[model samples]
Target: MQSLFERIDRLNGKYNALVSLDRPRALQRAREADLAQARGQSWGPLHGVPITVKDSFRTAGLRTTAGYAPLRDSVPDRDADAVARLKNAGAIVIGKSNCAPLCSDLQTRNDIFGTTGNPWEAGRTAGGSSGGEAAAVALGLSPLGLGSDSGGSIRVPASYCGVYGFKPSIGKIARDGLIPPLGDPAREDSLTVVGAIARSVRDLALSYSILSGEPYGIDAAPQHAPRIAWTGEFPRQLMDDEVSSALEAAYRTLSDSGASVEKVEPPLDLHFLNFKYFMLNMYEFSPRESSPGLHKLFWLFESARSVFSGGIEANYKKLKADQREQVDLFDRFAQQFDCWALPATPTAAFHHQKSGRPIPIRHRGKSKRYSYWHATGGFAFLANFLGCPSVAIPIGRDRNGLPIGIQVVGRREQDTALLRTAAHIAERIGSTMPLAT
Candidate 1:
């Protein structure tokens, strides 16, 4: 544990992966764990493992800002449910990792902490809002990290950093003490989920079981090969050659491994689903309070309903309806296939740029401006929208040597099954491809 801290101290400056360190307390806990072992007391599964939590999760006595300026010095009186679970399992919290501002942006950078860089490529983004967690684990700073996913936050970073990230079905893990708290209205949208990012699939399963208060055997692989469904493209989505090729290779490998592989088209229109997701996200992120004077002005602005799309309440209703339809479609599809495999992202990690600027990409032999979120979240948004479990695993690298990932998605509330499938795929892929060092 001490050696891990020393390595973090040495590499943090270059990666900017961690925002706050609780080294003294962590070392003290490590000593206590060692003494407990010496006394012949049964230690927990994590034992003395050192792990980092995303800045958005409130850690007791440790500053958690969620990349917001207002909470820069705010320390919580109690740890978030996930954090407490890891601690009870004997894992020592070493520090808080960087995240997107208010967990809103696609890239991890804010006024409180600077940008986190990709460990594989110096100038490229690490991916966010869980960018720090993924980069830290990929660089060997920590073996495991806890991150939150809302609209691809966990999967995108894991894909970019060449690590494993898993998002369980909604309500599987308790969501308490998370910053930018998901209050009643946000719950209606139901997009955010706390998840884990790790260097290995087994570590992901271990940490997930601990956090979710589930047992180890729940994620065990099936005795026989499982049926898998896959697709290389989605409606109105474009993929870089490298990403498309890696996904194809993964499908071929799974087929060769005795898994029943089938190519299938998604039931719903992806572009329309993405639109509903965007509307709901905007409504959830919208400010709730306003000054009296501004309130009247805002009311007048809202009164012009025809000019604007709709009110937040109306958008929420439409989002709920869309969600139900999408869920039903996925449920029917899941009845036939055990899991669906897709590209984690359309492109590999790109050069770091300021948020809100259009990123240029080559598609169909032409240059085009791509929204960062649209590029990373196109395939990922479906899982969150339908409230299903999804796992991202590193498949191989692109022509430029950047990592590419494939996501295995399962039916709602079938997180363990999803993890088991992910483990099988990871074993096959890891044997053939060398992961990012």
Candidate 2:
């Protein structure tokens, strides 16, 4: 356990995945854990394990700035609910990981910690806002990471970094200690969820069990092989050739391995989902950011725009009807398959671009202009959009030798079963893609 601290000292400078250190406190706790184990006392499953939490989630004595400059000195008196659970199970909080400012951007960069580079390649982004957590886990800085997924924060990073990330249903974990407290936590966190990132499916399962207070069998077996409905095609978008081909290979490998893998057009309509995700996400967070000076005015303008774009309580309630319809459609469609699988992103990690600019598609003969949000979250939004549980598992590397992955989603609130199915697939397919290093 102490070696991890030494590793942090040796390697964190290059990856910049971890932003803070609780070395003394964490080492002390690890020693205690070792003593307890010697006496045959166990705190729980994660005893003696060291982990990191995204800076967005507060840790009692650790500074949590959420990668925003103004909150650089902010430290909480209590851990976020999920972080507390991990500690209760004997997981030591080694440090906090870097993230995009205020958790608003899709790539990990801030004036505070600089940036978290992809472990697989130099200059490529470790997809954010869970970028640091994913990269940290991938690089062995931590065995597991606590992150949040609202608009693909967890999925994108896991896909880009060749790790496993599980985003449970929204109500699974409380949102009491988010860096910037949610305006009306229960409601505002509707689309966001606490998630776990790890190097193996079992780690995700174990972390999920501890975080959500639900049992996730690390080697749980299915009565029968899971039936999967998967696709590599997205409506109105062209997947980069390498990614599309990697997914196709995964589909074939899974089919040959005995899981009932079938290709079909899912009920997922990226066109409708992308817009709804934008409006609903805006309604959830638009006015909550109160950065001062120009930033404050910018958010104020956003609030006004929300009002003009239908953000009143009445309009929110109206959107609920749309939400209900979409949920129903997914629920109905999901009845035929045990789970759904698809590409986590259109492509593997790309070189860092100007923070909010559009990135054109990379496939030959295709030049559709795509926003950073669309490129990364087009497929990922479906899980958060319908409030479903999804797991991102690295399948293999793309032509660039960067990792590519798939997101397997299951029914909302049925998290354990989804992990089991994903684990089963992971085992059969060997989730043995090469390490980033």
Candidate 3:
């Protein structure tokens, strides 16, 4: 059997998943882990496992660019809170994976390191923001990896690559070291979160447990089976045939498994949701005065548009406004059931170039526009905006053989139930196929 380091080295170039591989350090850690196991010393659940982190994470002594040119040489002096947690669990940090510029786009291509393609189909995109981590995990370059989801970053990649991704409720996991750390530091926001990407839903739960300091803490309660509201449409928006088909199949499987599944046409405004997300995301990038170039142009243009449309305040304010409204909506929505279900993305993995611009897509007698090209994450964003937990599990596949995933969303601080539901789905449908290393 090849060591994890060897496996990574053997497949790193094939997927372009990693921007920097810590070979010397990784080998050293593996050797230490081997020695510890030989002595019968134990660390934790993640002991001896090699993992990867998205480049946005601050890993001590390793370059973390967030895929920006100015930060290309930047290295953190300390690990982010999540990184420290995984390290404490005895997980080896092998390397940092690629990401979009400032982690703003849907595709993982930036001037600093170029692109990271899907392991399933080399010609297709792996999905963004967290695309690199998803690709790495899908290819078995790492069994588990950390990726942040500020609007479907983690789940999108996981869905596109046939892996598991989980975005826990805001504040359930510490946000102390997250990039652009939360303003309140302790308060959780709807748009930003640190999540995991893995080969199995069980792996996702395990990683979350270790990172959150709660072993086996994810609620796997059968009694908490939620009154699921399945929507093939994008909230109030449209959907694609591929997306609709995947969601329909997942609903059927869940219904077959004895879950209380129902279809509800809730009064939701998806176009506003898309615009709200664009406003907030653009505002996020505008403040980063670093990396002067097209990126600055990209942020400034969107930021200005948001300001002109909603008033020239700030992105944080716009996000807060949208979130406040979403919270109100959820407060009312919570009375009905435990959670909502939706397609993680309208379609499976596509060529990277096609995701470069926002466009309109149709599904189930609805036609709507996405404000940003990489707006496939529209459905998943609502859960994040409401500070709720959600897990993405592989459902089935499309005509082109791409993986389709279903998102199980729950109330804030209800991460345990969310993971449990996802695990249930995985157990029923069977987990997505694993990548060969």
Best by TM-score: 2
Give the candidate order by descending lDDT: 2, 1, 3
Tell me the lDDT of candidate 2: 0.83
**Pairs that collide, model 1:** none
My TM-score estimates for the predictions, one after another, are: 0.92, 0.93, 0.87
What's the lDDT for residue 403 in model 1? Answer: 86
Q: Candidate 1 residues 218-332, lDDT tens each?
A: 4554876877888888778877766777887878887888778899987668888888786666555422331236446645654566245667566456668877988998899
| Superposed Cα deviation of residue 218, candidate 1 (Å) | 5.2
- Give the candidate order by descending TM-score: 2, 1, 3
Give candidate 1's error at residue 21 in angstroms: 0.6
| Model 3, TM vs. native | 0.87
**In model 3, what lDDT does residue 100 have?**
81
- Each candidate's clash count: 0, 0, 3
- Residue pairs in candidate 2 whose N, alpha carbon or C atoms collide under 3 angstroms: none
On TM-score, who's better, 2 or 3?
2
> Which segments of model 2 are wrong by more than 4 Å?
182-187, 286-311, 364-369, 433-435
